[model samples]
Target: MGRGGPREIVQLTGDRDAISSVTFLADGKTLASGGGGMVWLWDVSYLVKPLSFLCAQVGRSFTQEEWERYVPEGPAYRKIC
Candidate 1:
């Protein structure tokens, strides 16, 4: 939303973190995740492009034009930055 809610969509799965439970909150925008003695709350909202989100977390931002140079065009991929 324009008000600035969660701005990213992240995929978390049992194969990755061993999630034991999942449920949506009554508001419908929030999700609860549980696994390994931890509970995580997530809010769904408009998301930035994947590359842009990564760049921001590391203290920078990239436009789509900039991202094209570093990302491959197809299934070929690189795992580390």
Candidate 2:
């Protein structure tokens, strides 16, 4: 047997005090992550270039109120207030 390097290509970190989980959207064009007691949507269509950083950085520093603003209806999929 031969040893191999890790195959992972992406990493995301955010709101250390409140993050719960991170998930990908159905189409893979976006990312949905939970943090600060809420979920957020990040555009990932530009993963081939620098824009991917924006998606990864999107939820890294959200406050509770800011999370609520982005995911106003709470952690569920429904978009309501």
Best by lDDT: 2
Clashes of each: 0, 0
Q: What's the CA error at residue 66 for candidate 2, in Å?
A: 37
Q: What is the lDDT of residue 71 in candidate 2?
A: 45
Q: What tens digits encode model 1's per-residue C-alpha lDDT throughout 1-81?
A: 543455433575444465788888787767788888888877653232454455556565444555566543422443323
What C-alpha lDDT, on a 0 to 100 scale, does residue 72 get in candidate 1? 34
Reference-based TM-score of each model: 0.37, 0.40
Question: lDDT for model 2, on a 0 to 1 scale?
Answer: 0.59
Q: Give a tens-digit lDDT track for model 2, residues 1-81.
A: 223544444565556567677777888778888867688777866664433343366735455666567544335333122
| Model 2 alpha-carbon drift over 4 Å, by segment | 1-4, 7-13, 48-81
| lDDT for 52 (candidate 1) | 45
**Lowest summed-lDDT stretch of 10 residues in model 2?**
72-81
